[model samples]
Target chain A: MAKPACKNLEEIFRTPHGAVYQCNRANCFWLEFAGGISAFKASDFLHLKKQVEQIDVPEMVQNTARMADIVILNPFRSERCFVLTVTDVLNLRELLQGAKVMLDLNSMLYDCLHAMAV
Target chain B: MKDLLRLRTSLTEEIETLLNEQIKVEAHSSSVYLAMSSWCNRNGFDNSADYFQKQSGEEREHMLKLFGFINDMGGRAISPEVTNIPQEFESFRAVFETALQQEIYVTQQFNRIADRCFKAKDFMSFQFIQWFLKEQIEEEYIARRALELFDVIGEEGTGRWEIDKQVPKIKYEN
Candidate 1:
């Protein structure tokens, strides 16, 4: 039921050029890149994040001699391969970590609810 | 300030992820059993084929049960992408050995999920997984018994044929 670019999505991670939102209706994560958006399943979303995190930005930055070697994050969508720099990698990692924390917090509350129930 | 995340579903992200993982495990088990069944059929073990086929069906049932529970609880139930199911096994006895190993793996996974549920204080999910824990007992028992046939009957001459005949009749009473 969640169409792309709709306010219905819950923002999980946000950056300057992009943000990742969870759409419970579709049970998928929507990655908002630029003015456009694309959807990825939960596993795929995690996979993408892992791939991004595995990129050694500092190493790349130094190896490329201060010029960004363009870390591209493609999410099954042809157009939205996220182009990144060393700084952008750090920001993306921060956003993903924040989102993961929120997700864990939500899960923790749900788990606690059962214990509180008589 | 608004709890938009929980607005759509009561299932939390951790529990959902665990359930999806279990689904994939069940699907993988099903595929492995089906492959075993086919291998048995090819090897002229008729009774063994039937037993493996039944096991495959039961594994698929387990997958569906978890899938239904996730959807019923307003969580997303992912249709797992199963991979790396080995088509060729070493020998006849090796199949049951592999089966026992798989069941033990499944029990271990369920235990991990239950531990997470208890740690999170999610008794509902913990209670839900109890059925699977019990079922694993029967699964492991049958698999062990089936492997014992290879030892008891001894695969010398007609021993394997006799073992194949007994495979379909092996049952757990309680």
Candidate 2:
């Protein structure tokens, strides 16, 4: 018989100060937290995190899902490590679908910003 | 003179300008590919090097196609100014990544040229550029696929080494 999966959400959410929970499963809920801050502020990362949670439902879980692989918290600033889960890794396939969209969007925004500056 | 002929002449001139820009980009692409080939050869990736060497020839062929088209239109074909190619590469992956980037640049250039010709009502030049636009798609695909293969093999895998061995031996007929 298949073993019932244990709920590890609490362990997954636990993190050291100035750090966040990062997921490592093929596809699961994983994210990092700010070090030294109480775990109560988990709501701050809810923006993109909500999109991932939706994938758990059978009807909501499509063959493809767009999820961030490495969530960089204040990526440009400090040693804020990114978290990724197994589900997030699997979701990368969807993110790559029509992969040119992000690249084209970036170039378009860059051109627009440059034009504005000029 | 008929209004159609006058419009045709004006359209041809516009196409000439766009084609000139395209030829310059092609020249740049050829140089970049040659440099990449040389880097691959030096880094024990002879297959990748040979592949880029062929790619350089292909880009030159693309330039020639534009050159011929401009001459056929009775427009003055300007000499393309190609910049110097960089000699050093940090890794094989970097070389292929650069090639992929160049291919994307070339594809965008071709699209711009084709759009300009279309706007000018120069159907002939637009049709000619259509082939080039299609070619760029394939070029980008090949470059991207090469990079993906490199990723699969890893930076120092025997698979990459074996593929490198096949590089010098493989020769394109055209």
The chain A TM-scores for the candidates, taken one by one, are 0.76, 0.21
Q: For residues B1-174, write the lDDT of model 2, one tens digit per residue.
A: 012212223334346667888889888889989999898878877677778899899999988988887767655566788777788887777887888899998888888887887786678888888898777767876776677766565647487786555434433233
What tens digits encode model 1's per-residue C-alpha lDDT throughout B113-165? 99998886678888999999999989988999999999899999999899999
Each model's Cα RMSD: 6.2, 21.7
Tens-digit lDDT track of model 2 for A11-118: 322212212221222222223332222222212233233333334444335435455323332322233343545444334324322222332343456557779999
**Which is the leading candidate under lDDT?**
1
lDDT of each model, Cα atoms only? 0.81, 0.58
Model 1: per-residue lDDT, tens digit, A46-82?
Answer: 6576677788876786785545576777766434677
lDDT minimum window of 10 residues, candidate 2 chain A: A34-43
Supply the DockQ value of model 1. Answer: 0.14
- Each candidate's TM vs. the true structure? 0.72, 0.53
Worst 10 residues of 2 chain B by lDDT: B1-10
Q: What is the interface RMSD of candidate 2, in Å?
A: 29.2
